[model samples]
Target: MIEVRNLTKRYGPLTVVDDLSFTVQAGQVTGFLGPNGAGKTTTMRMIVGLAAPDRGSVTVSGRRYADIAVPLSEVGALLDAGAVHGGRTAYDHLWALAASNGLPRRRVGEVLARTGMASVAAKRAGGFSLGMRQRLGIAAALLGDPRVLIFDEPVNGLDPEGIRWVRELMRSLAAEGRAVLVSSHLMSEMAQTADHLVVIGRGRLIADTSMSEFMRSAGEGTVHVRAADPGALALRLSAAGAGVREGLESSLVVSGMTAGDVGRIAAYHGLALSELTPQRASLEDAFMELTAGSVDYQGVTS
Candidate 1:
């Protein structure tokens, strides 16, 4: 498991991460979400000991990342896919890392094949496309077969098939009891991949909750009701303190009320309903609603 407590970082006068605390538990995929300039990169850097925190602590398992004798064996990270040396072949690069970390050379080959980079192992990283570079980076991260993994935008340049591969890979990693923390801006993918979420905005913690709970807490969701007598049902629902609006095909959109309550009201008034369905907010809609104030850059609207 990965733990972050009271973590803070600053540059000049601007504080980036402020008193952020969260845990990435074992056997689960925790999504790290934030708008641009929300200090996500800084937090990830601090966790891996690439950047020093001004206050607080980050630990993998029970010890700091730096304290681990074989850091790569305990924690694997892919912060920047393009940070590799372009002059080196993919195989050479993995071999170098394994050598430096005292890992077996065969592990390099295993990871290359695991990440679907076996065919391009001899190719220089400089000649690889962005997607290929991402795969190579993933291969490096898995070389150590670490118990904990951190990935920042792992699917950045991947195509649909590659994206699906990553999604499945993350799930499989968590299934094996590895703590996986991934940060990404793709809401649709995140919705499908993450079991839990840690959302941040402007260097502070906004939300940390299970994906299902977060969606439920986003709003009560609107209820769609189509009754035999639309006008009378709307009147009764409005009088019961529910916000009712006209919807397509003479249906009523209702808020501030549950489906059960709507049904009860309809039944109480002897109103026959043709259709009653609840429409919950999508992940993208909920994210935008919650992070509205935290966006650092907003485009001008005409």
Candidate 2:
């Protein structure tokens, strides 16, 4: 597990991260979400000891990342996929990292195969495409077989298949009781991959909760109901304090009530219902709604 407590950072009088705190627990995928310039990269850099925090501390397991004897074996991070040396072959790069950390040379081959890069092990990283470079970076992160992983935009340049592979890989890592914290702007993918979320905006914590609860609390519940007598059902629903609006094909869109409540009320009034469906708010919807006020750059929408 990773614990960040009272984390803060500043540059030239501008506070980037403001007393942030959160935990990435074992056996789950925690998503790190934020708008542009929300200090996500800064916070992540602090966790891996790349940047010194002005206040607070970050611990992997029970010790600071810098204090760990074999840091790679305890914490693996892929902050920049393009940070590799272009002249080195994939195998050579992994070998160098393993050598520095006293890891076995055999581990390099294992991660190569794990990340589907075994075929390109002898190819220089400079010739690799963006997606291939991403794969190589992930391979390096897994080289030490670390118990905790932090990935910043792992799927940045991946194709659909590659994206799915990354999703499965993160889930599998968490399933092995390892703590995984992934930061990505792909809400659709995060919705399918992450079990929990840590959302930040303008360097402040916006939400730290289960994915289900975040979605549940971010937006009002909306239900679509169709009945034989649309007017009567709408009137009854309005009388019950539900905001009713006309929908397509003689249906009613209802707010301020759940699908169960709408169905129950319809049943209580002996109303014939043709269809009743509850619409779930998507992760994109929730993110936009929760971070509306925190966006640093807003484009004019005509």
Candidate 3:
């Protein structure tokens, strides 16, 4: 398991990650989510000892990363594809990292095949595309077969097929009882890939819960009812303490009332009900609501 307790980081006069505490358990993929510049990269770096936390601690098993004799075997990470040498072939790069960690050379072939980079194993990294470079980075991360793995936006520039490949790869890694933590700004993708989530804003954790639980907490369930006289329906629902809002042309969005309740109300009022459907907010909707105020960057039209 990967455990972080009150983890904090700072640079000069700025604090990026602050008093963050969370646990990434084995046998599942936990997504690390936040807005741009929310310190996700910094936190991942601290996890692998690439950058030191100014406060608190991050540990693999029960030991600090620095204290783990063979840190690679305990935790492996892919922070950025560009971290590798541009002039070196994928094979050569993996060989160097393995040599530095005293890992066997055969594992190089294993990870290359696992990440589907075997075809391009001999190609120089500088000549590879972004997706191929991501695969190469993942291959290097798997070189140690660590119990815990971290990937920062592993599918940033991939096509649908490549994204699916990465998703399946994460699942397979967790199936073997390894803890997996993947960071991404893509909510739709993360919803499909992660079983749990760690949502953060302004360098602080907003939520640390299972995907189902977080959705349940932030998601609202409403009933949509359409009637010939929505004004009458609205008045009745309002009198019944159900919040009602205009929806579409002749429909009312009713809150605090179930479909059955709406049906009963319509029958009691002798109203002609055309449609009544229940709507529950999705993960994507809930994420937008929760982080609406915390978003740091957005694409704007000039």
Candidate 4:
């Protein structure tokens, strides 16, 4: 598990990360979400010791990343897939990382195969496409078979198939009992991949919650109701304290009432119904509403 407590970072007059606290638990995928320039990358860097925090602390499995005797064996991070030596082959990159961590040479080949890059092991990284580079970066991160993994925008340039592969890989890693934290701009993918979310805005923690809870609280769901006497049903529903609006030809969209309550009222009024469905808000909707004010750069039309 990863623990970030009151982690803060500043550069001159600009504070990138504020007093943020959250945890990435084992056996689940935690999504780190924010608008661009929301200090997400800085926080990840601080977790891996790439950038020292101005205050507070971060730890992996009860020890600071720097204090771990074999950091790679404990925590693996893929912050930048393009931050590799462009001149070297994919195999060489993973090999260098393995050697530096005192891992066996055979482990490099294993990771390459695991990431489906064994066939391109000898290919120069400079010639590889963005998707290929991402594979290589993941291969290097898995070289030590670490129990904790962190990925930043792992599907940035991936095609549809590649994106699906990454989604499955994250699930597989967490199934193997590894703690995984991922940051991505793809809300659709995040909805499918992450069990929990850590949302931040303006360098401060906005929400730390399960995906279900986030959606539930972020939206006031509407009930879709259809009845033989539509106008009558609407009047009855509104009288029951539900806000009703006309929907389609003969349906009513109701808010501030539960499906059960709607049904009970219809039965009480002897109103024959054809449909009664509850529509919950989507994850993307919830995320946008939650971070609406947090976006630093808003593009406006003249």
RMSD of each: 3.2, 3.2, 3.2, 3.5
Candidate 1 residues 1-302, lDDT tens each?
99999999999899999999999999999999999999999999999999999999999999998899988899999999998999999999999999999999999999999999999999999999899999999998998999999999999899999999999999999999999999999999999999999999999999999999999988977899999999999999999999999999999999999998999999999999999899887788889989999998999999
Pitting candidate 2 against candidate 4, the one with the higher TM-score is: 2
Compute each candidate's TM-score over C-alphas: 0.85, 0.86, 0.85, 0.84
Residue lDDT tens for model 3, 1-302:
98999999989888899999999999999999888888889998988888989999998888888898887788888899888799999999999999989999999999999988888889899998888888898998899999999999999778999999999999899999999999987787888889899988878999999999988896468899999888988898899889899988778999888889888988999988999999987677788788877787877999
Question: Compared to the true structure, candidate 3 yields what TM-score?
Answer: 0.85
Q: Rank the candidates by lDDT, best first.
A: 1, 2, 4, 3
lDDT of 4 at 285: 78
Any runs in candidate 3 off by more than 4 Å, and if so which? Answer: 222-277, 298-302
Highest TM-score scorer = 2
Pairs of residues clashing in candidate 4: none
> Which clashing pairs does model 1 show?
none
lDDT tens per residue, model 2, 1-302: 99999999999899999999999999999999999999999999999999999999999998998899988899999999999999999999999999999999999999999999999999999999999999999998998899999999999999999999999999999999999999999999999999999999989999999999998786766899999898999999999999999988888999889999999999999999989999877899899989999998999998
lDDT of 3: 0.89
**Candidate 3, after superposition: displacement of residue 13 in Å?**
2.4
* CA lDDT, candidate 2, residue 250: 81
* True-vs-predicted CA distance for residue 187, candidate 1, Å: 1.1
**Candidate 4, 1-302: lDDT as tens digits:** 99999999999999999999999999999999999999999999999999999999999999999999888899999999898998999999889999999999999889988889989999899999999999888887788999999999999878899999999999999999999999999999999999999999989999999988887796667899989999999999888899999989778999899999999999999999999999876678788889999998999999
